[model samples]
Target: MQFTQLKVLAVSGSLRKSSLNRLSLESMKLLTPTGVEFLIYDKLDQLPFFNPDLKNNPTIEVLNWRKSLKQANLVIFARPEYAHGITGVIKNALNWIVSSGELLGKPISLPNLSPRASIAHAQLSEILSVMGGDILESCSPNASLITPYVIPCDTAKNLCDIAVINHRIRELWNRIETAMITK
Candidate 1:
């Protein structure tokens, strides 16, 4: 893809302030390369439950969410798995845009914070693919950081303290840049 500027929209499924998934995205912001705009879509919790009836006139929050997705060159998601599946919060967000097709042909990176959550990762990949998103397999790394439901700390500093986690974050960004060049 040839672009004048690359805008990346990062999203976290967890609503908690101490979520490692969100912390990881924050760390990613610090390592974002120049000329790339990294924005975190933090209003997933504000979106109303997906109902087909509201397609004609969606809520303001839904409109804003779709706008961000449509405007981004890439979408990076860092979500924690729940009960061996994707969290309801992220799933609900995707459902809101499934019919609108905002993710159609968009590059998506769904990085798993917990290595044990393979089932959720696969489910998310399938959902994104069904939404017509180009799942960047190379950029989606199994960043072995936390367990399925545990929060290490409240700050990105705690998550970035581990050298391996930091490397994985940097590598994820590198893979994203490389994907942009080779797309």
Candidate 2:
């Protein structure tokens, strides 16, 4: 099977301009393979708090968020943990789409930059699983464990080894291509 294009939507849990999670995903945009469309979703902060009553009459932001999710062949999340759990921005975004089923059976990758963030990673996995997402383990590479010399996100500069970053991005792109081709 061959694919002309593979659409991947990258979401960041942190809303800060210089967040490591956001920067890492932004950098991956440059390394995407040919015929792959990688979009970094930068509107988690724009979404309103989820309310079951508003599911039928969602705001424009909610509609746009769901549309992005529906159009992508796969969704990748680069998120930071707050108090040992996923950030509120990501949680809220997921909540908004949970009832609508945009993520139902959708392939998802949640890559972690820090080894100590395992708790948050597990939480995210559980949530995505409950939402009916196909959590792709192949795409969720931990930057710290991938490269021995690389340090975790303790500093802004020493995020991860360049080789690991490239490898992870390529792996993700390969998964996207494979999934698209198989579908």
Best by TM-score: 1
State the displacement of the C-alpha of residue 15, model 1, in Å, after optimal TM-score superposition: 0.6
What's the CA error at residue 38 for candidate 1, in Å?
0.8
lDDT string, candidate 1, 1-183, tens digits: 233489999999899866888888888877677788899999998999999999899999999999999999999988888999999999999999999999999999988777677899999999999999999888887744443322466677766776766777777777888888876
Q: What's model 2's TM-score? A: 0.85
Collision count of model 1: 1
lDDT score for residue 85 of model 2: 92
| lDDT of each residue in 53-164, candidate 2, tens digit only | 8999999999999999999988998888889999998999999988789989898977877766788999999999999998888668775554532233543334434666
RMSD of each: 3.1, 3.3
lDDT of 1 at 40: 91
Tell how far residue 105 is off in model 2, in angstroms.
1.0
Each model's lDDT comes to 0.84, 0.78
Find the candidate with the highest lDDT and give its number: 1
